[model samples]
Target chain A: MSPGPARGPRALTRLRSEGSSPEAIDQLLREQRVPLVEGPICTFLWRGDADGVAVDHRMPEIPIPLPLRRLKGTDLWYASVELPRGARIQYRILVRRGESTESMNDPLNPRVVGEPIGSQSVLEADGYLTPDWAYPDPTVVSGELVDLRLPSRALRRDAQVTLYIPSRMRRDRRMPLLVVHDGGDFLQYSSMATVLDNLMYRRLMADCVVAFTHPGDRLREYGASAAHSRFLTGELVPHIEGSLRLRGDPRGRVLMGASFGGVAALSAAVRAPGFYGALLLESPSLRFTEATPSGTFGDVFEPVVRFVNSVRAHPKKVTDRIFLTYGAFEPLAVPDRAMAEVLERMCDELRVMEALDGHNWINWRDRLLDGLGWLFPGEARLIYPG
Target chain B: MRQVTLLGPLDGVDLAAEIAAFGVDGPVALVTAGWEEGERNDAEVDRRLGGGSRNLNLYGRRLDILESDPGYADAERLLRTQIDELRELYLLRLRHALAGLEVIRRRFAEAQRRPGSELDAAIDAVRMLDETHTSSIAAAYEHFYAQNPPHERPAITRHREEVAAIVAGCAAIAIAGGHVGVLNDCLHLGHLAALIEERPLLAWSSGCVAVSERIVVIDDDDPAGRPDEIYDIGIGVARGMVALPAATSRLHAHDPDRLAVLARRCAPSVCVLLDPGDRLELRSGRLADLTSVGVVAEDGQVLRGAQAA
Candidate 1:
C-alpha cells in the first residue's frame, strides 16, 4: 500500500510565529528537515508510515498519551509544543502503524543524542547552541579508554567500568580520580572522553583518571542503595587504587553521575564521608513522591527521597566541593534547587550551573569543564604550570 | 591548611602591633594590589613589620607588564571589555528584576499575604541570572588564559617568580585593602595563590573579600541603590565566608529587609561584617577554633559571640 500524492498546495502549513517564510518552510518540509525557530511553539513534523505520533519529554507536569494530528491530504504527522525559550528536548516519534510498535528517533532530525536504551533526536528551540567544547575535533589529542571489571559482592555481580586516561599522563605523576556512575551511557552518548581531552589540552581541567561505572540493574541499584554505596566506596575505590596508581588523598577524588546515577553518587559520598573531595550531580532524582510526566519510569518513590533527605540532614559535609547542574526545562529543576539549598551549608564550596536544556547527555557533557574547573582550579592551572 | 587572619580597616587597627603578635621578625610580604598606585606610604607598615616589609607592588607590576607586553595587554583589554559588557547587562537585568520584585512586594502587601513561593521563585530567577553572567565571565577568562596563559607569558612569569621569592622569604603576607577589583586582578595575574602556598596570611577589607570564595560588591549609598552584585569568584583560599569589609558604613544594617537580602543572597557562606578593629582567624578556608564575630543571622540581626556568662 503506497502513500497518497507525492505533493500538493496544502502540503505546507505556514506557522506565522515561527518567523520563517512559507516558501522556506515548504522547502524545508519537502526535504524532510526540522525547522529551527526562535519562539515558544515548535511544530515537529514527521512524514512516513505512522498512524499516530507523540512526543515524550522529561517534564513531569505534562500528561502522556498526547497525540499528534495528521495533516489533511498528506501523510505528514505533526505536534506543536510550547517549550522554554532556549531549551533542548529529546523526543522520539511513536509510530502507531504497521509492525513498528516502538518509539523511533526522528530520522529527519540530524541532531541525535545516544542513551543506554536507544537514541533520541534532539530539538534545540529558540536558537540554542551546542557548546563549542562539547563537539570533538580531530586536531585535539584524545584520551585513551580501557575497559575493566570488578566483582561486587554487594550487588552479587560484576560491574564493567571504562577508565579514561589522558594522553598527557605520566607514570610518576599522581592524578586526581573521578568515578562517574552511568559510565557506559556517558562514554557513548555524552561525548565525555572528547570533553576531557579538550579540557585537559586547553588546561581548563587537570588530567585525571575517569572511571565510568556501568550498572547491572540501574533502576534497582541507583536508587540510593546502601549496597551500591558500599560497592562504590569499599569495593570499587580500593580495587581501582590497588590496581592503578591514584593519589591516595581523599582531596584527589571526585564522585559524579547524572539522573539516577546522580542519586547513586551522592548516596555513596554520604555513606563514606571524607572519601572524595568533590561531587558532580547532574539533574539528580531527589524527589521520589511523584512520577515523571512521560511515564518513563514506574512510580517508585521512597528510597531515593529518603536518601536525599538524609543527606540534607547530615551534620557535616560529605565532601569539600559540590557541583550541581540542572535543566531549566525539566521538572527536577525545583527539587534540584531545594537540594542545592540543603547542600549549601553541607559543603565548603557549592557551584551551580542551570542550563536551558532538558535532562539529557548533551547538557551533562557541556557542564564537565565548568564543574571540573570549579572543583579543581589549582590543579587546572598546574596543567600549564610555569 | 594555611593560617589566615582577617582584620577590619587597617586605618583604625594598629598595623605594627598586629604583625608583632605573629612573631614575624623577617620581612613581611606586603600585598598592596588593592591600593593600586595609592600604596605609597608604607612607613607605618614597615615600622610595624620591623622595617623589613617586602612590598610586593602587584598593581604597579601588572601595569608595567601591560605597558611592556602588547599581547598580554591586548588579551587583558579584550577580557576586561567582555567582562564589562557582561556586567552592564547583568546590572541592567538585576535592576529590572528588582523593580519587578518591588511591584510583587506591593501586591503582597496590598493583599495582606506573605510572599512565599512567589518571592522564592523571583529570587531564584535573579540568582540564575547572576549564575549565567558569572559563567560567561568565567568562560571569557578561561578562553584568555588558554590562549595567553600567564605561566607561558614571560612578563607574567617574571612577576610570579619575583612574587614567589618574596613570599618564600617573608614570615607573613599582609594583603591590604584598596580597589577590590584591582587587587583581585593583580593577585590572579601574579599567580599569588600558588606562590603563597601555606603562608600565614593577614588581610584587611577588600583583601579579605578578594581571598574569599566569591566577591560581592554592594553600596547602599550609591545613586542607583544597586542590590549586592556578586562581582567575582575568588581564589577559594578563604572559604565558607563572605567578608563584607566596611559593612557598617556601606550597608543599611538597621533595615531588616536589606539585611535579610544580604544574608539570604550568599547563604551557607556566613556573611560577616568586618568593622574597624575586628579580628578573625581563619583556618582551612573556615573559621578557626577562635570565636567568630560579626555573623549575620537570618533574623536580620548581626550576632556577636556570647561569652559564657
Candidate 2:
C-alpha cells in the first residue's frame, strides 16, 4: 500500500498494520529515500528482519558502529547525524539477522560507485551542484584517442598510456599536455574524454593533448613510491614530449589524479620541481599518522604517511597552482582540509572545493572541468561581448 | 617587426603619448573603419596624434567604391539582405538551444536520480545546434566574398591602392572602437589584414573584437537574456584573445558562474578586459609577458594590468 499522509508524530501506520515490526516499518520509510535536509542533520531510517542496524561509513575517526535505535512504541528504527553541505560519501548498513551479522549495500539507494573491494551506495549531501558544462556536449568535435605502450626502465615494466589529441590542432602544431594518473579508471569510469572534448570545443581551455597513464602495480606504485615518481618524470614525460608535438615548456603541463593517484601526482611534482605548471588533486590520500591517547605517533602506512608528512612539512617545495577537492562526508576530509591549509601558504593560486559526493570516480569526474580549465586556459580567446 | 600595442580606450588614454612610448618617428596611420558614419571625422584623433595622423576612413572608402561603381551598390544591397535573413534565423535557433540548456541544468541539479546520460544528451544537442548555425554563417560569409572579390572590381581595386599608399608612409596604425559589428565589416571591406602588416598597430575597445580570432557576444543581463553566442570568425590578427571592452560596466563581475562561463568560453588566451589605463603589447599575435594586461582568471576574479605581473 502507498504511504498516506502522516496523521500524527508517529507515521507509517500502513506498514505497521501489515504485521511489519517497528524496525521493518522504519526501514521502509527510510530505505532508498533521499534524506530530507533539515538544517544540519540528515535523519536516516531503516527496517528489515534484523534485530539491530548500524551505519558503517568511510570516515576514519567516526565509530564503526553508529547504532540505529527503534522507537519505543513502534518497530521502526531511526538515526540522525549532523553533516556539512556538499559531503558525498559511501556507506553500508550492518544488519543483524537472527544468529548472523551481515554488511550490505543500501537496497534503497540507486546511486552507487564500484571500488577495488566492492560497490558502495552513494550519499550526496545537500550543497554542491554540478556545473552544467560538466556534462558531455556531443555537438562539439571530440578528440582522437590512440593507445600505446612504452617500456619503463625505472619501473622495469611496460606502461600503457592512452593519448587524446584535440581535432582542432594541425598535425604539425605542438599543443600543451595534461597527464592524468590512474588513467584507465579515469577514462573508463570518469568520462574524462568527453569532459576534455566539451571544454576544448567551448574554448574554455586550449586545444591540447592528454596522456592517460595506466599503472602496472597500482597499490604499490600509487603510494609514495620513488620508482613510480621516477617513471613519470624520467621515462613517460620524455617519451610523450619526444613522440608527440607537445609544448616543451613545463608551464603548459598539468598533472591530475584522485585518491592514491592524487598522492602519486603530488609525489611526482615534489620529486621533479618545475616539471608541471599545475597539479589537480581530488580527495588526495594525505593522511599518514595515527595519534594514540598519549598524543604520540602510533601505527602508520610507512611510505605513504612518510611522504605526506614530508610534503606537509615543506609545502614550498612544490610551487605550481594546486587544485584540491574532497568530499565532506568521507574520512579523508580531515587530512584533505589540513593539506589545503598547507598548500594555501605555498602556492600562488590554490583552490579547495568540498563536494557532496564520496571518494569515487564519480566525484573525481565532476572536478575535471573546473580543475583543467583553471590549470590551462590557452593564450586568450573572447568569451563575452559587450 | 609584427607588433601590436592594445589599449583600453582612447577616451582618456592619449594616442600621442602611446605612440611616443613605441619610439616611432614617422606619421601614424589611423583605421576608423569601426566608426561607421563618423569614419571621416578624424579631426580630434589627428590632433591627439600631434597632427601627423592620416585617417584611412575605411568605412566611407568602402561606400565610395560601391557608390562609384555601376551596379556594385545593387549587388551589395542584395547580399546584405540575404546575410540579414540568415542571421535572424540563426538567432532563433540559438534561443531554442539556450532554453534547452537551462532546462537540462535545472533538472540535473534538482532530480534525486542523477540525470547523467540524459543531461549529456541535452548538452550535446545544444552544442550541435550552435555548431550547425556557426558553420552555416561561415559558409554564407564565404559565398558572399566569392561572388564579389574586391580585387576583381575596378572601383574597389583603386580604393585599395589609395589605402596602401596611406599605410606605406605611416610608422604605426591606430584603430579606434565603436560598434563591433560595424567595425568588423568595415575592416574586412578595406582588407586591413593585408595592409597593417609589420607596422605596429594600436587598437582599443571594438577594435580588439575586430581583430580577434572570434567574436563572442555576451550581455549577461540583456533584456532578451540569452546565453552568449559566437557571432562570427574575426580577422585573427589577435590570435588567442577574446576582447571584452568596458568590461567593468558590461560584465556581471560578482557572479562567479557567469564569470566562470565567460572565462571558459574564451580559453587559452586570456579573456582580455579593456578597462581604463590598461595597455598591453601583443606581439606575434600572442600577448607578451611584461606588457600583457588585465585577464579574467578562472576563479571569477578580474586580474587587472598590474596583477598580470
Candidate 3:
C-alpha cells in the first residue's frame, strides 16, 4: 500500500484509496521533497537600495527524472532544481516568506545592520566583478603543448603541459605573473583575460603575466598525484620563469584555479614555500575518499595539510599570504571549511569569503575583485589611480 | 661543549647516550634514576668520599663528575643550552629536528619574502655544515654537551669517532634522503603513485599491504570467519609471490600457506629463503635444497635430501 498524506495533525488517508486522487497526492509529495537552504546566506551590495526587492527563481534547464517541487513554508522556501555540478547562481526572494504584507529587511543582508519587520527590502544580483588585474581583452598569445619532465628521474614519463599567456602587455617593466591550471576551461569560461584588461585599464592591478596550464590526460596528474606537485615545483615554475621572463619573487607570483585546480595551486605553494605568495581558490575540491582517492590528481590535500601544520608549528618558515573564497552551495563546502580553518590557523594573514551561491565560475568571477583587492591591494591603487 | 648523561631505563638509553656524546664537549653530567635518586646517590657518594669532593659519582667510580668542572665539559654547552631553552631561542627548532628525524625514520610524519644573498649565504653555511661534518653523526652528543656544558670533555676523541662511524653506516642504509612525506592515516592507491614520484614516503601497515599487485588478503581483523583473497601483487619491488626466509616463519604463522600459494601461482619458479642456513637452487622450474641449508616441506610433508624436490 502506498503511504498516505496527513488529513490532520495525526490522522492520515491512503493515497490509493478508492476516491483518492493519486496524481495530486503525488504532486504534493513531490513538492514536499524540494530542498531548502540549510544555513543562512549573506549578501553585500556595493551599490543598491533596501526597498523594492524581488527574487526570481529560475529552474535549471536540464531535465531531472525525479519529481521536484518548490515550497515556501514558514520563513524559508525549498526548491527541487537540477543544477550542474559546479554551477552557481545568485538570486533573491520576491518577498519575505512569512510576512505577506510586510516589507522587512533581509536578516542575512551583510549591509543592513537593523531593519524592522514588515518593511519591504530590495535585493539585486551583483554583476560579476572581475579582478582589476584581469586582462580586459586577453588575446591568446600562444597555445602549445609543453612537456613536464622531472629533473631527477628519467624513467618517469613526461606530462603534456599546455601554456597560455595573455597577449595584452605593458611597455614599462616586466608584468606580474599569474599561473592558472585547467587552461582549456579557464581560457573559455573564466574570462580571465578580459578581467585582467579591465583591471589594467582602470589601473586596479599592475600589468601581470598569466600562464594558463592545461590539465594532463590523467586526472590524478593534475589534481592529486605527487608528480603534479613536482610538475609545478620542478617543471612549471622554471618553465614560466625562463620562457615568460617573469619576476621570480613571491610578490610577483600568483596562482589561481577552480575545483581541483584550486587545491592544486594551494598544494604547489605549500610544497615550494614562497614560490607563490598569492593564491585564488574557487570551490576547491578538498575532500579525500579511498574510492575516489585524491592521489589521482596528485597528493594535494595531505601535503597541504602537512605543510600548513608545519607552518603553524613553525611560523617562521611560512611567509606566503593567501586569499580563499568558496560558495555555500558547493558540495565540498564542508571540506573547504576544514581547509580554511587549517590555513587560518597557519597563515599570518589570510582572507576567506563564502559566497551566497554554489560552486560556479559565475560566483567565482564575481568574488575575484574582492579576493584580488585583498591579495594585491597595491594593484587596486593602480586601477583606481588615486 | 656541554655533556649530559641520562640515567634511566634502557628504552631510550641509546638515544640519550648518542645525544650526550654529540651535544657536549665535556664529560657528561650523569643523573641516575630521578632527581631524587640522583640526590640520594650524590649524598651517598659524598659520604663515601668523606664530604671532601664536590664531584658526583656513579657505577662505583667508573664515572665521576661535576657539572661545572672544567676538566670534562665540552663546547656544546657554551653554544646551546637545555632543550627547553634551545627551543625558545629558535622557532620550533627542537620540535622540527625531532619531527624531521622521525619523518626520516618513516615514522608518522613555506613561503617567505625574498631575502638578500647574505641571508641565503648564512643559511647555506648551516646546510653545508649539516651535510658535511661526518663528525656530526658521532659528535651529536658532544655537540649537545658543548652547547649546554654540564661536565668536562674527555681527554681522548676515540669514543666520538667510534660513535660517528656506527651512525654513518646505519644512516646511509636506513634513510634514503632528507625528505619524508606524511600521508593520511588510511591507505590510498595515490600513495603508491606518490612513492613512484619520488617524494620521500611513509605508509602504515595497511598502506604497505595494498601496494602489492598480488597479496594474500587475510580477513583476520574480521570477527566472522571470512575467506582470504589472493590478489595480484603490488607495484613495489619489495613485495611479490615469493618464499620468505625461515626466520620469518617465527614472526608469521601463515608464511607456509602463503608460500605454497605463491609457488603455485607465480611463473619463472618460486624461491624460498629458509632459516637455519639453507639455499634452494632452482633447475628447470623445480625447487631443490642447495648447500644442505634446511629441510624442505610441501603440503605439510618434510622432504630430506641434499637435492630435494
Which candidate has the highest lDDT of all? 1
Rate residue B122 of model 1 by lDDT.
73
lDDT scores in order: 0.73, 0.71, 0.39
Q: Model 1 chain A: which ten-residue window has the lowest total lDDT?
A: A377-386
DockQ of each: 0.02, 0.03, 0.01
Kept native contacts, fraction for each prediction: 0.00, 0.00, 0.00
The CAPRI class of candidate 2 is: incorrect
Off by over 4 Å in 3: A1-172, A288-319, A378-386, B1-309
- For residues B8-43, write the lDDT of model 3, one tens digit per residue: 112211332243333322222221211211233445
Q: Candidate 1 residues A1-386, lDDT tens each?
A: 11112232232444333434545556666664473342565666776657667666664455464466666555566666566666777877777766555677876688787776778888887767777778787888898999888788988998888989888753324677899999888878888888888877665666788899998888779999999999988888888887776775686789999999998988888889899878999998877333444223344546787666566666468887789999876878988988887777767767788887778888888777778765543222111000
Q: What is the TM-score of chain A alone in each candidate?
A: 0.79, 0.81, 0.56
Give one digit per residue, the lDDT tens place, for model 2 in A26-142. Answer: 565555354433445554456555689887776444556667777556645656666666666678878897888898887656667786568877666567466565677768778
CA error at residue A78 for candidate 3, angstroms: 11
What's the TM for model 2? Answer: 0.56
Q: After superposition, how far is residue B166 of candidate 2 from its true place, in Å?
A: 18
Per-prediction TM-score to the true structure, in the order listed: 0.51, 0.56, 0.35
Candidate 1 at A85: error in angstroms?
4.2
What is candidate 3's DockQ?
0.01
